[model samples]
Structures are given as C-alpha cells and as structure tokens.
Target: MSCVKLLNDFPFTFSREATYQVCEKVETRCSFLDKLGIHLAGIWICECSCGSSDLPLDHLRSDKGWSLPNRLCPCRGPLSILKKQLCSWSEYYEWRGISLDSPVALLLHWPLTMYQAIQLAFGKQLTNETTDELCIHYLGPERELYQTAVFGELHALLPGVRVHIDFVGPEVPHDRDGETISLSSYAHCMEANCSCKTPISTDDSSKITLRFHSGYYHDCYEELTKEFLPDLIIAPNAGIAAYKSWLPTIELIREIEVPTIFSDYCEEACHLAANCITSVTGTPLAIPVQLNPFRHPLAVEDSALLLPCYSNCFLFGI
Candidate 1:
C-alpha cells in the first residue's frame, strides 16, 4: 500500500472518550502479529524541547529571545534539559482524570514492548529480516533516557530493529566534585563533520547508529529530512517547544509527507503542529479534550485514532 494510504488507514479513531479503548485494540492486534513471528520496521521521529519558562532571563531578553545562539543558563546548563527534569508525570496524570489506584494508570509502567506494539499497529510493519530502522531526535540532558526508552521499547517488540539516534543539542554535561564539565572531548556527530553511519550493537544483537548535530531548527530539518529520510516521525512537544517558533520544522514534515506520531506534553506546541498539519493536508485538526485545572488538551479534527496517556499527554497519528 502507498505510505499515505497506509497512514490514513491506521486503526483508531480520535476521541477523548475512547482513547483507552483504542490502546487496547492496538495491544490486541499487535499481540496477534507477535504470535506469527512477524517483525515490522519503520523510521520514527523522536524529539524533545524545553518550556519557555525554563529559558534564562538574559536569553529571554535578547533580541532573538529564546532563539539566540548558545542559549544556555548562567550555570552553563541547557534550559531544555532543566525543564525536562521539572516535568511531573504524576501531575500530568492527575489532570487526565486518572487516579493512581486506577487500573489504567498501571499502563504507564508497562514495558517498552507494549508501547512498540501500539506503535507497530499504527504504521505498516515489515515481515522481512531486514532490520527496522527508528530515527530519534533529542535535545537537552534527558536524551539518554529517551534513547533508552526507544531502544528498550523497540527491543521488546522487534528484537532485530536498528535504531538511529541523532542528538541535536549542545555537548552533554558531567558533574564531578561540584564542577561542571562539557563532553566536548568526544567526537562531534554533525552530518558535515562526522561520518553518517556509525554502528553500536545492543546486548540482544539489535544495532543502533548514533549521530549528533546542532539543535538549530534549520540544521536539524536539513539533516533529518534531507539527509536521513525516515518512514515515520515521532515528534515530542517538549523538544519542539524549545523554540519560540517551529514553523520550519513543521513545514519540513509537510514537505516530506512522512507519517508522524506526535506526543503532546504542552498544549501550545501541540496546537502549532496540529494547525500546521491541518493547513498542509487540508484536514481540520483540533486540540484533544481539555483536562480541568491543567490546560486544554490537543486534539486533531479527523485523527485515525487518539490515545490519551498520563492525563495531559496524548499520542495520535496523521
């Protein structure tokens, strides 16, 4: 089937009331595929961004605002990384109408295999031995966690999937004896400066190729879409929220015509992406249902399916 047609046929209808039901359906379908020893492969986009409040006072005051170059705090820490640390997953759930004791809440602690199963059910999964490739774009300090999640989840679902991770931010920092040290001593991963293909193997024989590049939106778009074409995009609101404006990245996705699975942490970034996609595809998109005392949730007008997780966070495809 054509890629666009496949995306349009994804098995879930967007509805706040039926989000959990859709997740259950995905799980059931993926379970059936696993029993057949079938493996599916596709490229997925994973990205992170910081909250605007995390920006430093000076950086926020600059003519370019949060878009200023070398945007870091006085302590030499990336604001995006700091904001990630501050995000309260528990609070997010509380806002979603899910209590800690609820059975659905247990899904949060489910293994990455379950998550991958859900993802595989959304897009076309390959049955061949050819390694499935997943492309991840991350910024700030939480990248390691994001990488671990991606790897773990894929490993759970498809043990042979290959992962390509692109770290699009400043050098990771290390703290030793109260001194902060930048890992600049390590080789850079820019498409221009480094070899595009470098392989690292996991314990289970899954291979991962790692790359690092500047987090500037234009640079990231050039490398991800033009240099490394992916089948699916898994964009995180936090990563995209780092910028005051993410039109270029949104436009890049529209131009590439790749199926994207967006994770919404903040309502504003989610709305921006939904609106951009709506304009491109001429499909009306709306924010998800609002969770009281939190914020209006992001919802797409004609999504194939919508699954709300952790209350405020949502997963949907277009």
Candidate 2:
C-alpha cells in the first residue's frame, strides 16, 4: 500500500459533556479518554528553569540538579546526565503547568535502548551486554532496588493503574535508525560509521504498524514528519496532567491531523501504545526516526566495525 494511504491512526469523536457540571480538575479539560478508563499521562521533558531536583545514585542524601550540556533544566541548572536521568514526569508536570500561561510544549531526546531521564513508571527488565564492567551500573543492586521502590510506591498510589514501556517504534523487520543514535554501550554492535542494515534485516516489503507511547502533541509529531514523514503517529491519550515537557513532536501529528493510532498503553508499554486499536483503518505506522551508523561521519575503520547493528531505527524520534 502507498505510505500515505497506509498511515492514518489518530482520531476519534466523543459526545460532548457538560464541563460546568464536572469537577474543577475534570470539567476544565476537554479529552475523551476518560471514556476508556484511560488517563493522559503527559511525559514532559522540559528544559527546567529552577530544576525540580535530582539526587544521583551515588549522592542520595543531598538533592542535586543535573549538570549542563545535558537536558536543559528550566530549574536553572542541569540535573539530568549523559546516562543518568534527572527528573520525573509527575514532578515536571506539577511544576510546569503552573508556570506556563497557555499549554506549553517541550522537546524530548531519549536514548532508544538505554533510558537516561525518561523512564517507564513500572520498570522493565533492563539488559546491558557491554564490555565495560561499569556498563552493569544500571542493573546494579541499588538501581534495581530503586526500580522496585519506584514501582512499589507507584502501585500504592495508583491503585489500578497499568505500567508500560516504549522502544524505538516496534521492532520491525527493517533495521532501525535514529537521529543522534548513541552507541555508548553497544558501540561494538556497529562499526565506526557504516551503512549496512544488519540486525534489523526484516521483511521490508511487509507493512507493520509502528507504535509508540508518548505524552507529546502534534506539533512535535510534525517535527519528525518534516524531517521524515512516517506512515502514522500514535499516542494513548492527551490532555494529560503529567509531563513537565510534553514533546512537541507528537503534538505535530494532531496539528496536521496526521492520522494516528491512539492506544491506552501509557499505563502499559514504554512506547505508550493503546489498549485497543479501535480505528482499524489498515493504516501503516512508520516513524522516520532511524539512523545509519555505517553511513555516519566517522573514521573508516570504525565504520567498518559498527556495521552489524547498522539500522534505520536510529534516527530523531524513533
């Protein structure tokens, strides 16, 4: 099917409700997600101004902020890290909502496999097979304990809420590429910079429904479209109360009315897919966010070594 005809996944109509009759927090908003017993979890990764706060794994007693050159903390200081995450969606949303006049937008830079700041509420089985011993730092006792504690606390707070994680679009038969694809841990997976779709040698001819779990808007979704128009863009629900930085990338899809797949998986997958694909439009989903390691601007020798994992899934917002 032609890509244009195959990409339509993001809209549904709902009967309007009396806003004035609903509660303050409920009535002021205009979203139809409540019908599906779903809540819009806006994951805002904002450039903090005063920095909500961060206490690295090493230093937990004293609260700290992420350093600069990383995520711009509107908290006025960099609190995240090259590999470490600095904040949380819950904290970010609470603070940013009060700060912005109209709805605010943000840009999100996520490490496809290795999550730094943006993480799924319910932790997943994290895997790292790097040569360096420190690579296991993410899976250490302390980190695992942290994940357990985070989930424990969340489970207590959000009674029946589900948890999910997101990967660079679902693993297609095609190799994945991304923009600024970081090869820190799995550098050996590819050569310095080569262009050979290695691992993701999938049935490219077969169309797949690429999915994602996001708390962004259509404007940001369009950013990916402008860079590389994918088949369809999908998200669980919008009009959320979380996310200090709802990426403008997803928002772009809505603005352009790019057909999108809406899922209720914000509470399920890391990719924020939906519970059920109600709109069976035979739409194909593709996020033009892939990177070609073999084709990167690197030394020839290095490029030769990093060819195995050369995928198109390493791009901007995959």
Candidate 3:
C-alpha cells in the first residue's frame, strides 16, 4: 500500500497530501557526519513519555514511517489513543530510511516550515525556477545547530535552486560563530541501493549553504547585511509579544522593508505577533496569521494550554 493510503488508517489532524509532500523531503537517512564531525553506532535510541528503547539500525524500513505501529508508546494518558496513532521524528524519517544518530522532528520542521513560508510569501513558481537563487535570513535558531546537515533536503524540495541561509541568534554557540558550511549534495540514505546514496555529481551546481551569526539580530543586523542581502527572513516560534528583545529587531526589519515571515506555537501567539508587528511597522501583516501545513506532526508535551500545540503551528508574514 502507498504511504499516504496507510497513513490515512489513523486519525491525524494534518492532511494526508501535505504529510506526504513533507515526507518526500525528510525521508532521507543522511547524517551529514562528514559535515558535523561525528560518528555513530548502528543502534538508535528512541525516547518518549514511556522511556527509552534501543532500536537497531538494520531493522528500520521505509514502510514503518507512515503506518501506525501496534504500540506507539507506553504512555497511557487520557490522550494516548490519539497520541499512540502519531509517529515520532524517527518513525517519520523511516519512510525514506533516514536514521540519524539523534533525529528530532524539529530538524525536519525547520527546513520544511521555511519552505512552506517561502511558498506562502513568494509563490511556488519562484522556487521551481532552476536559475533563481533564494537567500533567507533565519532568526532565533536554538537546537537546530546540531543537525545542520539535515537542511540539505532543501536542494531536493527546491530542485536546481541555490538556497543561502544566514542563521542569526543569541543561542549560537561561541565556538561556531561566523562559520559557514555548504551542502553540495543531497543528504543520502544509508541504504546501499538508494538513488541519492552517492555524492551528487559536480555538474549539478545547486546547493544549500548556511552561515552562523552569534548575536541578537538587532546587534548583528548592520554587520550581516554588509555582505549578503536576503530575499526573505524567517523567525520560527517567535514569541514577539512575550519578549521585549524583539523590539529593536522589529524596528530594524521594518526599516529594511524585507519580506519577513514568523511562526509560533499557537494562533494566539501569531495574533499577538501580528499586533506587535503592526505596532512596530505601522502597517498590517502582509500574510495574516494562519495554520502552517508543515507543522510538526506530534503533540508537544507539557503545553500551557489544553489545545494541541506543535512547533511552528501557526505562521504570518510582514
């Protein structure tokens, strides 16, 4: 059975078509170990509310990601029925046989969410062009630094286009500051026969390159812009109303007049951000707050509200 048909056996909040589209980009097994300078064994540890279990790498298959397993997790909370039907980052990646040493859904979320935001702001026709280059300034990155290699999926999603991302945030580690990394090939799966298992030929010039800037955007804005100007700016899980630190950044963004997009965990957060953006920029949002189709599939634990909350659940542009 097809992955989409199998996925429909369970009750998921997201559309099957959307999930299938995202899985295509995220299903690869490439660890980018050469890029991150890390080594690993054949066992991947699975963690959840139930606990951790060691899973052998060889046992994982592409079919496991879409179909709900007999036992999702050991947790038996009130919401376990729906939760058990949901899969983790590890399971989702299994569709394409991706088995990174420590895979997190956010690893896929960052790139996919950004891709969707770009489509929302600029339309899909622009990304489909083979000759056009897309430059993005990503703000407030925290845990994503550990798995930058996973972002190589962009090349597949935006085929033949070069994507340049400048990640600016205070959470950037001191040691990696001002570092630049380029991914010239698709993140390959471990399977020996996988189509993308080999390095991309040099003839394919498209690539995804990332740069790290260690500081608040307001402080680094003037300096960063000196080198590369971006076509778009993305801020994921931006708590605009909750933080005063965003004030200067918002001011600067308004002045630059760049097409900026932001995602938050909930509608209320996006609504508040919209108000904040208008307050700072003196204009309404270009893209009103709406649900992001590329949101993380699993429910977030210990959420403040009773409503379902996932990473980058809502998005808006200014």
Clashes of each: 15, 97, 1
Best TM-score goes to which candidate? 3
Candidate 1 or 2, higher TM-score? 1
- The candidates, ranked best first by TM-score, are 3, 1, 2
lDDT of 1 by residue, 1-318 (tens): 122222222122222222333344543323322332221211101111222123322221101111111111010111121111112324433333333322222112222222332343343343214445655543332323222322332332344555554544433222111121112111112233232122223442454444545454344566555556665554443334445445565666567765554555434446665666676567654323122121111122223434233322434445
For each candidate in the order shown, give its overall lDDT on alpha carbons.
Answer: 0.34, 0.22, 0.60
Q: Lowest summed lDDT over 10 consecutive residues: which window, candidate 2?
A: 131-140
Which candidate gets the maximum lDDT versus the true structure?
Answer: 3
lDDT digits (tens) for residues 1-318 of candidate 3? 222243222223233322342344332122222122222322111212221233332222111121111122111111111212112344334333433332334345767787678777775434433346778999998645544655765665565677888999987766678888776554433444544444555433466778988999999988888878888999999999999999999999988889999999877788888888899888899998877665765444455764555678888998
Error of 1 at 153 (Å): 4.8
Give the poorly placed runs of model 2, Cα more than 4 Å off.
1-223, 236-252, 265-318
Q: Give the per-residue Cα lDDT of candidate 1 at 138.
A: 38
Clashing pairs in 3: 29-98
**What tens-digit string does per-residue lDDT give for candidate 2 at 102-214?**
12111111122223211231133222212101110010011111111112111111212222212222211122222221111110111223321122122322111212212
